[model samples]
Target: MKKIDRNNLKTFKDFLIVEGEKVNIVFSTAKYDRSFNRNNDEGLKNIESLKVDFNVNEVVYLHQIHSDNVFVFNNNAKEFIEREGDAIVTNKENVIIGAFTADCVPVVLVDEVEGVIAAIHSGWKGTFNSITKKSIEKMIQEYGTRIENIKVYIGPHIRQCCYEVSEELKERFLDKTKIDENELFNGRNLSMERCILEDLRSLKIEEDNIYTINLCTYCEEEIKLFSYRKSVGTYGRLFTFAYKK
Candidate 1:
């Protein structure tokens, strides 16, 4: 098992990869000199460059629809399908699974004991629908992954400090989870982390095994992380990926 050096980790341009017991995780930021948006040709080039850096044969990108749908990577398939889903899980090595997000939560789950990994995109809608929980259930059913042995990482996103929501949205999240109104909505904004953490704990994931970057994409101006809320309609996306190797 490779121990992760969280304090001494390095970044390649705006990309950062962290090693774990059985999986390698990578995250891309908007801080690079060039554009790292996954919506254009330049973004494709940057993604290819990351593939080399991570030493993965291919990177599977999802057609995210903010739905609870989870795609299970089938390496035995003849063709690579870009399916519409919010999360992906697989046991295949050397194939990086990834998702794009501007304000949504990018979650990576690794069952080191079972050698299974997952990449999830959890926006407000997806989180409300319990997408992360669904993905873990899928892994457990398909890969025999034990919930307690799974290590989870919740990447940067729009935190409650900057994620103001409408009354209807707040009520919907409240109805979906056990989080209190005060913690769920801080007078002006909704707490996405609180809701997500609650959902993970409900599924029996140990509190200590779950880690969060705790950085707000909308609050950190110096980091250059993409934020749809802050940029309005002119923002790019940050990529989060994971693979077992």
Candidate 2:
């Protein structure tokens, strides 16, 4: 099998790509490209630069609301519809499907055999509502994706070390997962990554197929990743994108 040519682009970090597969999974850093501040003109330029670098015809994303809703892209759609959802899936080639996050988990799911991919934004609210699980289920239902054939990459987010939560939120997670309160929450913080992984495994995704970048946005200030908890006044958001060539 041909090996995947990992791009060492200064703007983004290539997270996961299978040998001989047409798909590419990548997440932007605070390095050369700083599209995190999406409110200004520079942010728009950064996004355009990313599309150029990735060589995708268009970058499709959602106006995320931390909901469990997943939208499937229609290749023939005229203008990109600004939908309020948390996930996006598409079998359409050469178009980047993505999500923006500050401290929320950004997940990219790929079924190489079926040439289908999905991008998910799972914050505490979305994870609580089982958004990742719902997105995978939608992929299987609509695109005939096999659970075993799917590869998942969970990107940078706020980990338990830096993600402090209220007592009520902690109790809600405990009640939902039925895990012991102490096990789920380390003192006052909750690991959203753990909750996401548990949900993925519960959906029958193989443990080995799931991968995580393990970088905490809130903790890694030197990396300069956008963190909502760290700085909420900024309108910056990290853009994670995936596309099938």
Best by lDDT: 1
Candidate 2 structure quality by residue, lDDT tens digits, 25-44: 87776654365444578866
What is the per-residue lDDT of model 1 for residues 1-245, given as tens digits with 9 covering 90 to 100?
A: 12334355557767766777668788777876445565689877877776688788877777788999998997742244357788999998888888888899999989988888999999988988888999999999999999889888888899989898888887777777867788788886987778778888788898778887757889976567888888887648888989877
lDDT to native, each model = 0.81, 0.79
Runs off by more than 4 Å, candidate 1: 1-8, 33-36, 76-81
TM-score of 1: 0.92
Q: What lDDT score is found at residue 127 in candidate 1?
A: 87
Residue 234 Cα positional deviation in candidate 1, in Å, after optimal superposition = 1.7
